[model samples]
Target: MARVYSIVSGKGGTGKTSSAINLAAALNSLGEDVIVVDANISTPNVGIHLGAPIVPVTLNHVLTNRAEVTEAIYKHESGLKILPSSLSTQDLGRIKHENLVQVVKQLKRLSKYIILDSAAGLGKETEASILASDEVIIVTQPEMPAVTDALKAVKLCEQLGKPVKGFILTRHRWKKSEMQVENILDMLEIPAVGLIPEDKNMQKALMLKSPIVNSYPKSKASKAYFETARRLLGIKEEKGFFERIFGS
Candidate 1:
């Protein structure tokens, strides 16, 4: 059975969607079958990020019973599968959020990893995504506001009886002004799963509408994402200098 991981964040602009896409790509690179689902119905971006912003069939159709779940799935150029939600505002209300769990169950039967890129904040859509997943990977920046929101998300997941896999710290600069990894863990009480460095290549990849791992495999952010994937898969590997210093 495939494991479903809802990649969520407390607030917007936390690189949650980016982390979800890259992590799916990294797993696919390892010869694992992966599917990325845009559960962020209000602001779906998985298709946009993969250069297939508009498709005939989408998650909205599946949820509304207009199309089968399999029909909504499209294979990306990078060999990963994506089930993107409709970008149209009209389709938003058509979706029944309560069906998310069943939709995820169907998806899990089709791939090794089913990554649901959830919407930001603690809204109804986000809660449904959380309940539909096996576990959650909270994404946040290493700052006071982001960390505070991450803690709220973690607590929400706990109350819902959803296991939190860990936290992914994105756009990490390791600057003196930023909150240290230790402090973040101490505050959130969740182990650090990964740390994505701020890289211009990530922006370029976004412009190109491809995952950083595929567009610039040698970039720092790509390496971090790959490392995060490997760690999540429980694959043992040697730690690099940055990991030794920052402790991923």
Candidate 2:
């Protein structure tokens, strides 16, 4: 069965896109067929992150009746297939809300996991995307505004009948401990999947158009992503305490 997840943030620059791309790669590395659907049609970055060429066909093509969903999908060498959005400014606000749900239903049969990279802010498309997802991964930074927006998103997801699977904190400096994270979770009432500290290699990896998991597997950010994937899959037999500490 295909599990559909929506990765969203209350605000932009919360590393939501980065989280989606890296998590998708980690899941694929673990032998799961993953398709990352870049629903952030207005500002799609998955293609740029994965180093895939911007093509003529994309999610906009499918929604606009210019191409089939299958025809818009590009298979990356990293073993992750992507259904990217068009770069045309003309299609920025042209997405049909009804068609969004239809498109997701069509994609469910195509992969073991469908990770939707939603645009920041609560809009028609964002709401519909979350509503269609079975679970949500709310990404936040260790700041007040991001935390506020994340809380609103969590509430909205609950109202839409979508269970928030967990939260993921990114761009953290580790200056604060898990207590700060726990407080935010207490407000949103959701457990965290993991934390990804900010790293310079992330930008370098982005420039290279490859995920850290594949480009620099031993990096702290890469190891964090691996642990997040393991938790998401509920893999038993946890890693050694010292191994986890040393890796972090």
Q: Largest lDDT belongs to which candidate?
A: 1
Q: What range of 10 consecutive residues in model 2 has the weakest lDDT sum?
A: 239-248
TM-score of 1: 0.97
Q: Write the per-residue lDDT of candidate 2 for residues 109-177, one digit (tens) a residue.
A: 888889999888977767877976889999998888888899899988878888998888897776754
- Colliding residue pairs in candidate 2: none
How well is each residue in 155-209 modelled by candidate 1, as lDDT tens digits?
9999999999999999999899999888997998887788899999988999999
Candidate 2: list runs displaced more than 4 Å.
177-179, 237-248
**Could you tell me which 10 consecutive residues in candidate 1 have the lowest summed lDDT?**
239-248
Clashing pairs in 1: none
Residue-level error in angstroms, candidate 2, position 108: 1.4
Clashes of each: 0, 0
State how far residue 216 of model 2 sits from its true place (Å): 1.1
Shift of residue 219 alpha carbon in model 2, Å: 0.9
Q: Residue 46 in candidate 1 has what lDDT?
A: 90
